[model samples]
Target: MNYTAMLHTHTLAWFLMLILFIVTVILLKSGKAKGGKIVQMTLRLFYIFVLVTGATLLIWNFYWATGVKAILAVALIFTMEQLSTGIKKDTLQGSRPMVLWTQFIILVIIVIYFGYFVA
Candidate 1:
């Protein structure tokens, strides 16, 4: 894909992931563990999409900002996996909510940073 198309796909995947994450969080908060499973699966797919497209975008020019964003994106994926696993095993601790929110906030910050400074 062209750079423009790739960038759009990357952004779309990012937004979709964020939306699904929010929905998953809502389901978890509402005690709908079963319902959140589907969304989490979808989120995982988006994570792959984002990673692939992001790597494609960076292949042409290796910039520090893109590198940082890529690292942060991987971290977000790990956080998501951890949170989901904890939720699934019913081992969610009191600190989980804090961790979830903090990760989400970091995601938004990265998004804004990319929008204003990187892309």
Candidate 2:
């Protein structure tokens, strides 16, 4: 796809992933096991979409800012997976959820900053 199209796709994927992440956390907090499971599965797809589109955009034209953003994006994804695993293993509890979610949101903010301002 062209850069313009890829950019649009990346934005859509980013927003969708953010929304799904919020929803997943909410569902888990509310003890909606079934809904959380479904949202988790769907969230995984959006994760792939964001990664793929971001990669395409970067490979099309590489820059230091985009490189940093890409690295942080991958970190964000890995952190999210770790959070999920923690939740499943019942290791993270109490204030841990808030801490992890805050980190995730901060990562999103930094990524967006780099994507829009630095690049």
Best by TM-score: 2
The count of residue-pair clashes in candidate 1 stands at 0
Give candidates' CA RMSD values in order. Answer: 2.0, 1.8
Worst 10 residues of 1 by lDDT: 110-119
Model 1 residue 21 lDDT score: 76
lDDT of 1 by residue, 1-119 (tens): 68889888888988888788778877876788888888888888888998888888888657787777777777777777777667666787788768776986787788558755885
Query: What is the alpha-carbon lDDT for the whole of candidate 1?
Result: 0.78
lDDT of 1 at 82: 73
Candidate 2 stretches with Cα past 4 Å from truth are 93-99
Give per-model TM-scores.
Answer: 0.83, 0.89
Clashing pairs in 2: none
Local error of candidate 1 at 103, Å?
3.4
Q: Which residue pairs in model 1 clash with each other?
A: none
> Against the unseen true structure, what C-alpha lDDT does each candidate score?
0.78, 0.85
Model 2 lDDT at residue 91: 88
